[model samples]
Target: MAQTIVCINNAGMIMQFWIEWVNDDGTQGWTQANSGDYPVDQRRSLDMDALNSQGESIPPGRLVRPHVQAVAGASIAGDRYITYTPGSGTAIYDVTGTSFNYSVTLIQS
Candidate 1:
């Protein structure tokens, strides 16, 4: 796996994403269903990499596949990364959006 940063730009919205926890146990959690609510321990941001298959970055006018999106609470904006001890199982993420414009960044952890 590799460290990466993804920048997404659309019509009027722009997003910068960094994947901090990419453990084997990371899975897609739930929305209203309790089956997918897992508490995270800490919040941290990782760097971006292009050669890394485990990492993703997006920019405007790009197309991307649907994956678990990291979102903040209503009062907050954009996605956030959380870190915690490895769990007995993988952490699940929600699958949303099919296409995106992605710009990527690579950095050392």
Candidate 2:
């Protein structure tokens, strides 16, 4: 299988690619959900081959079960959410599967 590919851009500049973890249930417990440096660009591809190649079951998009930290302020574990640090225009890409493709447009704040 081919490795999942992702392309990100920001104001016509390739804003470093990165992955972010989010709360699966859309709950507020997870800091990564709506806080922190959202859509963080850490320069890495969200690799799913580990579970894909071996035919192991993997969540399609967001995890169905909420990630729990169970310590201090609990939080979700794993990549529960994936985001693209889009340029002024937009970021687009195909997911390993059809269900994963997404895009985010930057709005001047």
Candidate 3:
């Protein structure tokens, strides 16, 4: 069972997004899916297994946070902390906003 994070950007602007793992020791780390900024209407799929920190995978039943921001040098526009158990399935997050009032929607499947 593979876990994945799917981000759909409909914010009408270029946006940057990533997933951070909440380590057992309260440390935060990101994955390779944080490549760069994403254009409007773009959809990105990030495999949770891509997370690697000191040769460690995301522990089961851990918390994974998703972050999204405008690429135009602005602060984080939207974010959500989700408690995810590895091997569960796919988690889909939709980014939608207008005038910096951004919001993230978690679509359960």
Q: Say which candidate scores most in lDDT.
A: 3
How do all the candidates rank in terms of TM-score, highest first? Answer: 3, 2, 1
Query: What TM-score goes with each of the models?
Result: 0.21, 0.25, 0.71
Steric clashes per prediction: 28, 5, 0
Best by TM-score: 3
**What is the Cα-based TM-score of model 1?**
0.21
Query: Which parts of model 1 are misplaced by more than 4 Å?
Result: 27-109
Model 3 misplaced regions, further than 4 Å: 32-35, 53-57, 73-80
lDDT of 2 by residue, 1-95 (tens): 11232332222122223323235655422212211121223222334334334453333343222122212222322332333222212223311
Q: Against the correct fold, how does model 2 do in TM-score?
A: 0.25
Ordered from best to worst lDDT, the candidate numbers read: 3, 2, 1
Stretches of candidate 2 above 4 Å error?
1-5, 8-10, 27-45, 50-109
Residue 75 displacement in candidate 3 (angstroms) = 4.2
Cα deviation in Å at residue 44, candidate 1? 16
Q: What lDDT, from 0 to 1, does candidate 1 have?
A: 0.26
2 against 3, candidate with superior TM-score: 3
Give Cα-based local distance difference scores for all models.
0.26, 0.28, 0.65
